[model samples]
Target chain A: MRNLLKILYTYHFLLMFIALEVISIIMLVQNNRYHSASYAVKAKAVSGSIYSTVSDFKEYLSLKEANKALAHENAILRNYLKSNYGTFDTTKISVNDSIYKQHYRFQDAKVVNNTVNKQYNYITLNKGTKHGIKPDMAVIGPQGIVGLINGVSENFSNVLPLLNVDFRVSARLKKNNYLGSVTWEGKDFEYCTLKDIPQHVQVNKGDTVITTGYTGSFPEGIMIGTVSSSKLKDGNFLSIEVKISTVFKTLSYVSVIEDLTKEEVTKLKTETEK
Target chain B: MIGEYIKIALRFFFLVVLQLLVLNNVQWSGYLNPYLYVLFILLLPFETPNWLLIILSFLLGFTIDSFSNTWGMHSAACVLTGFIRPYFLKIISPRDGYDSATRPIIRDFGLEWVIKYSLILIFIHHFALFYIEVFKFSLFFHTFLRVVLSTLFTFTLVIISHFIIYKR
Candidate 1:
């Protein structure tokens, strides 16, 4: 017992180092796998509130720009109103409207904090469970797609933005409907990469890319970015660089998309799988 | 001695605030994100207890991680740096050896010695941070570039700030 005590005393620092590193690595692995699980939510709560206060000050500085974005979005929404589009198929007897109802809902939120320089970039929003924000909801700026909500607190939420290496959005070419995955390469905030695109499809510079709606987190036709360049890689697929539309530097306002039919869809999917 | 501990404690809060509020928001680029908080770990008194050094380093990193939402990446790297710091001190010690009363600042140790000491640990800290952040060897070259670029940027900042902030 005395010899074991002597050994323990001699290597105490090494043991402490190992213990601390083990705890840190465990936290990293846990947070990375289940971003919304564990103390991440608690950490977000404390940091989120602090960032909310700081961004509140920042938000005041950009009031004019925020107003301009709101005005622009209002004009776009006004153009899509029923009055502007006219009555839909007035000649037909419309019935069973439940089958064709909208499956997505939007809640406006303010971005409290955002980081584009990190490998795993995250955005903190001022909305949370109290504001009907939840994990897996899609976030979008007025100009383009922002990210998906990763965690939520009482009054704040975190988003896994497109700038993160782990973030992958299903996107398709607007012209040919060829599907590919969009993800950040951890280099530049203004650009991301589109993978899994076959070389046979001719892709041009400035080709529009939009969400595929396969995941249902985001609806179809929402803009993601444009192809900045493309080249055939390994003689099998196209390695394409896309210029993301949302200027992350100036992003402030966003809309969180809540899928109303998510529970039903997931339930049906699980049932079919079983 | 108590007064010295109080001063170190105050410096801790000051560095944490500066790191999270100003340095973290810079977003200069992926390659140039200078991690100035590690300066706190780098400048602890030469006579600081090994256990205290490890704990303080972990706390410094944990505080920064909390603010930045990095989920313990900084803490892990900081602990590693602290663990290896004693070996670094032994290597850079003068021929006559260090005075327990004196702190390890550039003013006391001279520019050359401090430069070598800071550069080695900063490189290790950044290398571990970037590699752990990616957790993959597939992008080894890119991660290494980030490690070197960030180390250079952070080392330059540490040197400049040492002269400017600690020239007294």
Candidate 2:
């Protein structure tokens, strides 16, 4: 055994490379099983602690802005209640118009350590297992979708930001319903590209882009961005350039949207991937 | 002596954090993500053991892996780099070489040797990393493109970092 090992080592780095290949194969095979079980254990404790700490950090930073946003949102809700008061015919005449029917959950979170400059930028959030955050959960800001959670750390999770080249969010024109894939070119934080839209879709320079409701993260009709420009790709498909509204680098606060059906949908998707 | 070892360890920790937290995040094009923190290993004292060097490289890469969630890429690259460092030292060995006392630097290894040394190591590290991250060889075009682009970016950044940190 010693002599055989020596002979292999005499092949110098070739032996090392072969060893690595074997390890890589083994890891690929065992990754899913290992990640699920171990993630359950480790993610709960570590991610939870990190999430709380980072949440504390973020609440401080967003105190003023968050208060303003809340006040504005409150004002809008109150005004909405006033306008539709006649629609309610209850004995008490309560002002309730579709408030209970809103389909979006706004779970506040903190960005722990986010990167917008990477071709594969990932943002770590302070909401995870404890906060009901899960992988593939839709993350958004006041502007639009920040990205989806790729890995969860129990109380904390990492988001694959739209600034990352890996992100491909399905979006459509609000007025016309022309759908396309929105992806970051891994360059500018202020811009992204929307591709595969038919050139005949009649795109305007400032038409609203919103989620198409094809995936689990965001509901259909959630705002993504406005069309910055449009061009003919291969002189057929419409290639629209979009300017993302979120400031990922300077971003501090976010909302992790936990769709009620996310768990079942993700479980099915994960099984399919395996 | 204990204090010195602790300081060295702390510096290694600092380099890795800065690499992932700051430098890895700074992407100009989708093409470039520089790995300059490995310079800590490159600049180590010449008497460092071969086995320890390999282990250090593995640890360095593993840390990066844990953060990025990409399996063994950084480890493979760092290990390959560690394996090649000694050979590089031999290739550029001078009559009164700095292998025993002097460190690998522009001042010690001279301008030409330093450039040659850094370029070779950067290519080796980036090749292993990009190729490993690109597990499926089926995507030949994409893997090839990344290898070329990342190597160029890594080479430029590593050289610039060396000049700034260890200027002759």
Best by lDDT: 1
Q: TM-score for each prediction?
A: 0.92, 0.73
Candidate 1 deviant stretches above 4 angstroms: A60-68, A82-89, A92-100, B164-167
DockQ, candidate no. 2: 0.26
Q: What would the per-residue lDDT of candidate 1 be over residues A138-184, giving only the tens digit for each residue?
A: 98999999998888889988888898887888999999999999888
Worst 10 residues of 1 chain B by lDDT: B22-31
Q: Each candidate's lDDT (Cα)?
A: 0.86, 0.70
Model 1: what is its DockQ? Answer: 0.67
lDDT, candidate 1, B11-121, per-residue tens: 899988888777887756666788988888888988888998999988888888877878779989999999999988897789988888777787788888889989999
Span of ten consecutive residues with least summed lDDT in model 2 chain B: B64-73
Error of 2 at A233 (Å): 4.2
